[model samples]
Target: MKQSALSYFQYPEMVLVPLILFFVFFMLLLFFITRPKNRELFKKMEKMPLEEEETNNESIE
Candidate 1:
């Protein structure tokens, strides 16, 4: 008799750890990226490509 792949995860704890870790990692990422303190930083990053030419022109003048 052959055991299906699901049989490997017969023990709940075996699957619980990875699920918990993934959830924690996702939440932390969401929190960090959306935090108020980092808002300005993200805004600047969003405009980087658009501002490149303006910055270059100022430097040349």
Candidate 2:
């Protein structure tokens, strides 16, 4: 039987490289989310629904 030519990415173990790349990107995303610079923005977004409800109640009064 003739042998087949496989490229670098065609190897099963080569899948690990992409997996590691995605993990690194995930860590970067977590870092950005937890950074202090965005803290106030996250807090305001967290309270957005409650604030909207308060305004709606006042208007309905």
Candidate 3:
């Protein structure tokens, strides 16, 4: 049997990097399109613990 550079990508594992990158790029584009609300939602999600703490503190007061 013989192999060439083109045959390298025929190997499933070897093709994964580009496939993964493609989807990652797609997701980034989707994220950018939803920019402002995405950032606000991300910030809200990130502050969940702080909001939870505030609720706990208020209940204790």
Candidate 3: Cα lDDT at 53: 50
Looking at candidate 2, what is the lDDT of residue 9? 32
| lDDT of model number 2 | 0.82
Per-residue lDDT of model 2, residues 1-61, tens digit only: 1244534335787789999999999999999999999999998999887874533445644
Per-model lDDT: 0.83, 0.82, 0.78
Model 2 deviation from native, Cα RMSD in Å: 5.7
Q: List the pairs of residues colliding in candidate 3.
A: none
lDDT of 3 by residue, 1-61 (tens): 3656667556678689899999999999998868886787787788887774533345644
Which of candidates 2 and 3 reaches a greater TM-score?
A: 2
Model 3: how far is 60 from its true place, Å? 84
Which regions in candidate 3 have their CA more than 4 angstroms from the true location? Answer: 1-10, 36-61
State the displacement of the C-alpha of residue 39, model 2, in Å, after optimal TM-score superposition.
0.8
Cα lDDT over the full model 3 = 0.78
Residue 6, model 2: Cα distance from true site in angstroms: 4.1
What TM-score would you give candidate 2 relative to the actual structure? Answer: 0.58
Worst 10 residues of 1 by lDDT: 52-61
Model 1, runs deviating above 4 Å: 1-12, 54-61
